[model samples]
Target chain A: MTWIMAALLVVVVFAGIGITKWMNSTATENANENWRDIAQAEIANSMVMLEEPDLSEPQADYYEGRIAIAEHRLANDIPSFEYASMQQQVIDTHMMMSLVTLLAVIMAGGIVASEFSQGTIKMLLTRPVKRWKILTSKYITVLLFAVVLTVILLISTALAGLLFFGISDGTLLVWNGSEVSETSFWLEALKLAALKFSSVWMISTFAFMLSTVFRSSSLAIGLSIFLMFTGIQAVFLLQNYEIVKYYLFTHTDLTQFFTGNFMISDITIQMSIVVLAVYFLVFMAISYWTFGRRDITA
Target chain B: MAEQAIVQIKNLSKTIGKKKIIKNLSLDLHKGEITGFLGPNGAGKTTTIRMMVGLMRPTEGEVWIDGQSVQADFEGSIQKVGVIVENPEMYKYMSGYKNLLHFSRMHKGISKERIDEVVKQVGMQNRINEKVASYSLGMRQRLGLAQALLHDPKFLILDEPTNGLDPAGIREFRIYLQKIAKENGVAIFVSSHLLSEIELLCDRIAIIQNGELIDIKNVNDLQKSRYYIQAEPLELAGEVLTGIGFPAVLHDKGYLIDSGAEHIPGAINLLVGAGVRIFAVQPYRETLESQFLEMTGGGEIAQTHTK
Candidate 1:
């Protein structure tokens, strides 16, 4: 089971890297020609939106800003950063961290629950080891698996980036609401990927807690995966309420602060970190309490 | 009889949701003794064993193993205890050797040599490398035994240790357990429903009925000598044996007399000289099954026994 999950992860990550590289390679082959065409098409598309009669003031400003960026790109001959480049791929790799979260969840959800299901928990608990120590060992192992898989994802992405597209020179442009400015793609990728890993760590910890509390891996994995999607959707649904500030999914994506896509715009990075830390503590406490106190009937 | 008790279960009570599963169960297990724990189904035998091994906590009282409390000092108390609770469930995904190695790591100072020695002791060296998934039930039991013995535990608690073993395997297991209990002076407590097996394996038997320890007796005490005599005119034979100070009781078309072999010969001579015709004479004994059924009130469930 251990080796199979890791092998599947490598295959999946490599496949994702291969597919993304293929999709992005065609656009960057003729960089200048492709940029000009893309900018013209983008300008035309934004121009139609700018012509809308009922467009709100901010909406109209957003479309006008997009048109301005495209026009400036064409005028300055600043082609959009090539997605096939190593820096861009490293920056974009975090987008696929949901896969890492999934694999980590599988590992965390089974680490302790499988012992109960297979009836080996009796053998495990009857030893000279205390229940708390056993639970701690399992929790540490789950954390290690998550960390290892995340590292694998990062390494595989870099390998794929290096293989398909060697180093490429391009300027990363970001519009700070009024004007486009230059940014370091490598720094941006590192920040975004690190932020994305916070979500993976939080979700996998949640899955681990469920695994120990319920002593059923299927239920833990299923419930965790289900909540991972629905919980994020719920943040948008509850955005109008005051409770959204404290809701777990609202803060799970720490990248929201940097990406200008906050579900609850009032929440700061510090607030999100605090909320996530609280949830993490509650999950860990429940896991330990239930595991240490549970009767080993299995 | 003068030996100190190595495992002391004192006033151990388990109450699960208003049901007293084990009611003030107190017993002492000494080294170099094989103590058989016999109980009907759901009579709290497993519950008591689990509490002793720290799998379940006792609601009241505690189990002390080797002068340490199992509830308070689990690691210290259970350090020298080997437990095989309910078929010795192991990680079937790994090899049998890996399973032993996995358990060996949980202890303080078990070496690779010790694991190999235990594997060889259980006669599993040939197939120790094969995954436990491929092993038969008997082989699994042996591997289970190997893991239990890995740490050279001073106290061994086995719950149905011979559940899947064949007759020969059971005999081999019994001999092995007896050897450890005697040679190594390991305090062994075994819970089993097999009456004849317990009779052969245990030096002392503790019988539990309806969440209570109803009887604890030495195997020798249950093996009193008596003789069954089949004679014509059973009434005359009974009178003749009773008049000769045998205290004969009529049972199954015969008179049962509790006496030594010398007295049995004389009693038979007097009975034959009288008008009673002696047809057969044989030794009689009460099986453990009958004694267990009698003590447990026909082996009904505890709920009925309570009312």
Candidate 2:
């Protein structure tokens, strides 16, 4: 079962790259011609946003930062990274992380629950080991599975990028408040992938909690995957409320701070990390508590 | 009988959803003894077994094995115990050998040779490499037994341990259980519906009904001295037995007298002197089946009576 899930992840990665190639080939011959003009237009838009009197402090900072990066790009003659560029592929590889999260949820949901379904939990729990220790071992196995899948995603994306897009001269520019500077695309890509994995970790932990609490893998996997798709949409729905600042989905994507995509303008990355930490704790607490207290009637 | 008990369950009770599944049950198992746990359906038999093995926590009291409390020190208590609850569910995707290996790793100091020895002991070496899904029920039972014996547990708890084995396989299993109980001095607690099997395998039997232990007796006590006599003129034989101050009860076409072998010859002489034609005489013992049914009220389901 694990081999099948891993194989499916690799297939999905290659299929994603294949689709990108097919789409890029159908575009006009001058597909790369107007990136410079697009950067200039983005700079003009951010400049206009900066002139609004009612713009919040973080909102104003966001536009100013965008304008600075765009102006720096226009001055340095640096174009926005195209979809087919090797550098962008490295960054876009994390976009396939949802699939990784799905695979991970499937595994975490079944690790403990499968024992009950197969009536093997009686055999397992009757061992000399403590119940908490067994649960801890299962949780570690789930985390290791997620880590291996992430590695597969990273290595596959790198290979696929080299094969299809080849090496391209692309400069990754980041604004450090006062100026824009060049950064390694590999470092940037790693940062995004790591941030994206936080979402995977949180969702898989939630699935693990459900699996332990309910002792049903289907319910755990189904509910977790459903929330994975709609959780962000809920952030959009709840954005106007003050409570949205503490909502889980709002903080799941830590990359929003670096990408300048703030759903709530006042919230800081530090606050998001704290919120995520709290959620992680709650999920783990529920998982361990229920697992230790459950009666193995199955 | 004077030896210390290896397994002691004291005032154990379990209440699941207000049903009071097990109510203040207590039992003691000694080394070199196989105690059969017999109960009708839904008589808290499985629940009691689960509690003993620490699969379910007791609402009150405790189970101790080899001087360790199962509730307080799970590892210390269960270290010397082997359990097979019901059908001995294994990972069907893995081979029988791997299943044993998987369980062997959970215990300390269980080497690869120990696993091989157990496989051979259970006579499963030929099919141990096959996946559990491909094995028949009898084969799975063998594998289950192999895994349970892998750790060489001092106290073995088996629930329906001989469910799917053929007669030959069952005899082999019964002999193996008896051997371990006697040779290794391991205490064995077996819960089974097979009364005749229990008669042949167990040293003592504990019977439960409606969440309570109704009786605990030695097999020997249930098989007290009695003899059946078949003769012509049963009335004359009964009178002669009465004349000799012996109680004889009519049974089938004969009379059954509770007597020893020494009394039987003297009684036979007296009957012959009275001209009572004796056809046959044999030792008589009641089957465990009739005794179990009699004790458990015909072995009816216990729950429906409560409602």
Candidate 3:
């Protein structure tokens, strides 16, 4: 089962890359001389249109960041740009982290809930070891799986980039208004990888907590994934209410605080971390408490 | 103060929703003995065993193992025990040996040598390396027993431990359980609805019914002494025996008279004196099945222990 998920992820990643490369080839040719330029303008205009109904701070950063990219590409940058460039390739691969998060939810949820579903939890719980240790081992295993997935994602993208555009001595650049920062390509890639994994871990841990409390693996996996993809949007819709900021789902996407703008102005990175920490502890406490008290009659 | 008993269950009760599943039940299990826990279907045997192993919490009261309360100190108490509740469930994706190894990691001082020893003890050595998915139900039961004995726990609780075994396998399991109890001084608590199996296996038997402990007695003392008689003029012989204040029922062969060995000769002499030619008289040993049937008031013997 795990291998199947891995193979599917690999195929999805490379297939997505192939489709994008083909589209770029077709769009870049046989059009007006400034067709690429026109596309950038359209992307910027779409970002501007997303600002209605009080844009989330993270959405604002994302929309405004696209505008920045279009402005820069239209200005003094190089004339020819390819998506296969190392940094762009890395970003494109990392952007598919929702796939990683989905698998992580299954892995984390299956670890404990499978025992219950299959009636094997009696053997697990009756051992001399404490219940907490069992749950902790599964949680750590999920974290390790997250690390493995991140590494696999990075390696696959690097290999793809090397295959498409061999060995380029290009600068890793980030645009912040008039100021631009340059860093080692690998270092920048690692930072982006960490940022992507942060969001994955958040979803995985939520799934792990649900697994502990639930006997049905499908329930845990389904609910966690459902919330992961829609939880932020739900909170965004509710953001008009003052209490929405206190919602854990809103804080679950802590990447907003660091990689972009905070949806709520007062929700700094520190506040987000504290909120996440509280949720983590509460989820863990519920897991241990329920596990200890649960009757394994099944 | 607990009489040297390794397992001391005190007033254990469990209630799920509005139904009181296990009433206040108490039991004592000692080392070097195999006690049969006999009960009909839904008699709370599995529920009691689950609470004993801390797989389920009691609504009230406690189960103590070697002076440690299962409710209060589950690890410390459960460390002294091994259990196979209802059916032994394993990860079918892994080999039997891997399952044992995984369980061994949960305990201290369970070595590869110990694993091999248990594998050999349960006679599963030949197929230990095979994936559990390929195992027959009997083989899985053996693996389950092997894993339970790996820790050398003082008390072993097996709920319907012989679910899938053939008759030969069951007989062998009974012998192994007895050997473990006598040689290793492990107290074995076997809960099964199999009366015949319990008759052959247990030293003492505890009976339960409808969420209550009914009775506990030695296998030897399960039924009172009775005699079977085959005689010419059987009706006359039965009438004479009944007239002499012995209640005699006419059986297929002759008559069934409730009398001890000493009175058998006297009854025979009376029958002969009454012109009844006595042919055969033998002491009838009551099977545990008949006793159980009589006790449960003709209750169903095929009790299913489902968890």
Chain B vs. true chain B: TM-score per candidate: 0.92, 0.89, 0.86
lDDT of 3 by residue, B173-276 (tens): 99888988889889999988777888889888988887888898987675578888988787788789889999988887788888778888888888988999
Misplaced by over 4 Å in model 1 are A25-81, A170-190, B229-250, B253-255, B266-280, B299-307
Which run of 10 residues does model 2 chain A get worst, by summed lDDT?
A29-38
- Report DockQ per prediction, comma-separated: 0.67, 0.79, 0.65
lDDT of 2 by residue, A145-230 (tens): 99899988888888888888877775778877788888888888889889888899999999999999999999999999999999
Write model 1 residue lDDT over A1-298, tens digit each, in one string: 7678777877886787788767765665564346678779878987997787765454555567667778888889887766567777777877878987888898889989999999999999988898889998988887788777767777777777787777667667666678887788766777787898889989989999999999899999999999998999998899889999899999998876655456764667788999999999999999999998988898
Ordered from best to worst lDDT, the candidate numbers read 2, 1, 3
Ranking by TM-score: 2, 1, 3
Q: What is the lDDT of candidate 3?
A: 0.80
lDDT of each: 0.85, 0.88, 0.80
- Cα-based TM-score, every candidate: 0.86, 0.92, 0.84
**Clashes per model (N, Cα, C within 3 A):** 0, 0, 1
Regions more than 4 Å wrong, model 3: A29-83, A91-93, A173-181, A257-266, B1-3, B223-280, B302-307
Clashing residue pairs, candidate 2?
Answer: none
Candidate 2: misplaced stretches above 4 Å? A34-42, A52-63, A67-82, A178-181, B229-257, B268-281, B299-307
